[model samples]
Target: MKQLIFSLSFCLLAMSSLFAQGIQFESGSWADVKAKAKAQNKPIFVDAYAVWCGPCKWMSANSFTDASVGELYNSGFISYKFDMEKGEGPAFAQQQSIRAYPTLLFFSPDGELLKKAEGARDAEGLISLAKPYLKANNNANQEQTTTDNNWESLNAKAWEYYETKSNRSDLSKALKWANTSIEMNRNWYNLDTKAHLLAKLDRNKEALELAVDAILAAQDAGELAEAEETMELLRKLRNN
Candidate 1:
């Protein structure tokens, strides 16, 4: 009986330590994050989340705890998870025009906004999302490379074409450009835009299919709110 009790105590301590070994919330002001990023010359990954947000909880449970995400983030970023309703972070959220919870904002060490993805991101998706930024930073120190530039410029042009196109016939070019963007970046936002353009072109069937794909992708990535929204949009498109 004494040995059994000792073993149980040891198990409990081991379990506690295991949990503690996972990602830890860094406590400090945004300035602290900035200072750390500057000192380390790393990007800052800010997870803007709220307590009441279901997707935020999912992200914490699934995506943020994923080992791949942990390795990538721990290596390249000064990651900070912010409670969007609890501190000065809330004010920053408003300034950043965050309309939803579980928004992931990536910033350069110099404090430039590199990307703002509004959704829950699973481990794989989070790692994928952060990769471009990390690559960009690393490439900055090397000889100039133009691999991503064409895709970046093409994506911008596609958005412009989308904004101006009003007819299905006019949308073909935009669709083509957006598809090219997806092939290059494979970002959720790019895919979402592609779906939007497809819907606008009266390709409701294809649009709904793409929307469903996007929904699943977002869900898998731990972007709960985005998944829900995309699902709702899919339903509405189908109904129409």
Candidate 2:
């Protein structure tokens, strides 16, 4: 009987250690955690809990501490835990439309809500809930990178033709490349390139409109140099 009890205790200790490691939740304000997520370009995982909730405590002691949960959450997400009833938590919960204890919220890097759930999840369930959002965000980031690369190449091609400007045909080709790039991304650089190409094609009105758009996009992106350049181009277009 004594040996059996000792064996049971050892087994329990081993199991505890097996699942001891878990998600490393960030200790920061909601704004700070959101900023970190944006900086890392990773999705945010918010554990909205209350001290009085049984399931919240269960998850804090079990599911959140599981090794697999830690591995996935730590690697793929900017994790945070907030008490729904304390500090900034109440305001955040109100803003997020959190209505229940142990609310699981996933947000994009830009702070858009991606997914939400109420109640506690087991380790496997939590992992399952999070995997799709992470995968979707990763895919979106990859696609945007690829699209940006393609737009850069097209923009470069357009610039080469614009620099040459040997004939009307060359100008037309430059406009085509610029149009393609703008279609891929309406970023300030591409929009400015398109505006200049339109100006070369003697479409002054369209060029002015595109230049304005470029300025606005630049302002949104905080690209002061691009905005300045677009302003100069806008003046030139207006003069024409």
Candidate 3:
């Protein structure tokens, strides 16, 4: 049984090597990989995975070996794989708050975490993940320096966009982005935005209660203008 396990492991390794010319991975400690990334002036791409995870295994077997994925990753980044359940992986996993089987983390060479995504991704999906990070790296001439994670900022951006953009797709994106902010914090403004978005969708049952709640909360806080605006929203929601 041990021999069979060894043979299987060897085969997997050999197969991975055949795809090695694609997304070549670093062969050293995690810290070493980070140092190499810094030295090379490149970002870090880590595949935080568990051995027994089926999706992790599938990704290793399939997506990691895709030539296009390899070309993009190998050209621009230092890649590393770690089994989060074992050895030094556990310590890093805890620091990174990795609660899932397969978490992909992208980091700056200076070791700042830039982005993260959960679950399995196909080659195309994985490639997509690299795009924003790549853009941030390549487009120094662009306005935004980093991706926005704060819900308040996102909520406000959504509001500004929604107010100015008449495109149906843009409206949907604004509403969706506001929904993310609402999920992050249910402050009055967040709830109000969510209520408005939900009302736009004709999601009356969901929108009505939140709009009313925001109105009452504003009234309690002596925020008369806010309460009045919320009441106006409640009227619109009811009319919907």
Candidate 4:
């Protein structure tokens, strides 16, 4: 009974070790990793390490397996581990100019190198190094969201005036709002709105030009559905 219990305990221990949570490193080419990062809107964290490096092995066995490290890296980054002395790893290391044993590289979603660090770090040290970049990225995303919201609100207000068309004065006010919206973001919807406002105000030539721009912008954004109205407007403007 005692031997059986010990065997069971050993099996449990082995299972736990096998399933231990850590930085979930992806298996793929560098291009695949970058593509995934772009799709997920997450940064890339590359562990450029060598097989014979003591520090690199120590980090892999200790710090990377820490739960906190796993949570942060797995969530915020598309992590990859490359053996710098083997296979395509040598070429990649050369390209990235990695000369050290355990170089940490942080890249933006678009694959721009954002940060680089050399040497191995404990879990706390690694977390501390990564936190600021993630925080900054989060803050930037929030600011962009706010800007988009503000521009959308402005566009809606402008469109309201366009729909009402109570007077020439209202059209003029709508034009101002539309211009501001376009300045904030020269996207198809706002461009279309501005073009319509210009047409209402009898600025046919400017309106036609803006309509064309809107159509092209819509196409570029893969928002061709929104371009149909703009196309119709362009046809009318050409006839006039």
Query: Highest lDDT: which candidate?
Result: 4
Clashes of 2: 0
* Best-fitting candidate, scored by TM-score: 2
Please, what are the lDDT tens digits per residue for candidate 4 over residues 166-196? 5554565566567878888889999999999
Cα lDDT tens digits, model 2, 1-240, are 999999999998875564467988999799999899879978899999999999999999999998989878888899999998989989999988889899999877767676789988999999999998778667656544554457888798777777786554445545656777888877988888888887876778989999998888888998867477679889987786
**lDDT of every model, 2 decimals:** 0.74, 0.82, 0.77, 0.83
TM-scores, each model vs. reference: 0.51, 0.57, 0.51, 0.55
Error of 4 at 225 (Å): 36
Candidate 2 lDDT score at position 138: 73
Model 2 / residue 133 / CA error / Å:
1.1
lDDT of 3 at 11: 100
Q: What 10-residue stretch in candidate 3 is worst by lDDT?
A: 138-147
User: For model 1, how does the per-residue alpha-carbon lDDT over 58-158 read when each residue is reduced to its tens digit?
Assistant: 98988877766676777788889898788797699888899988899988766666688988877778888989878766754331133245666656666
Q: Which stretches of candidate 4 lie over 4 Å from their true place?
A: 1-20, 149-240
**Which parts of model 2 are misplaced by more than 4 Å?**
1-20, 150-240
Which residue pairs clash within candidate 1? 120-222, 120-223, 121-221, 122-221
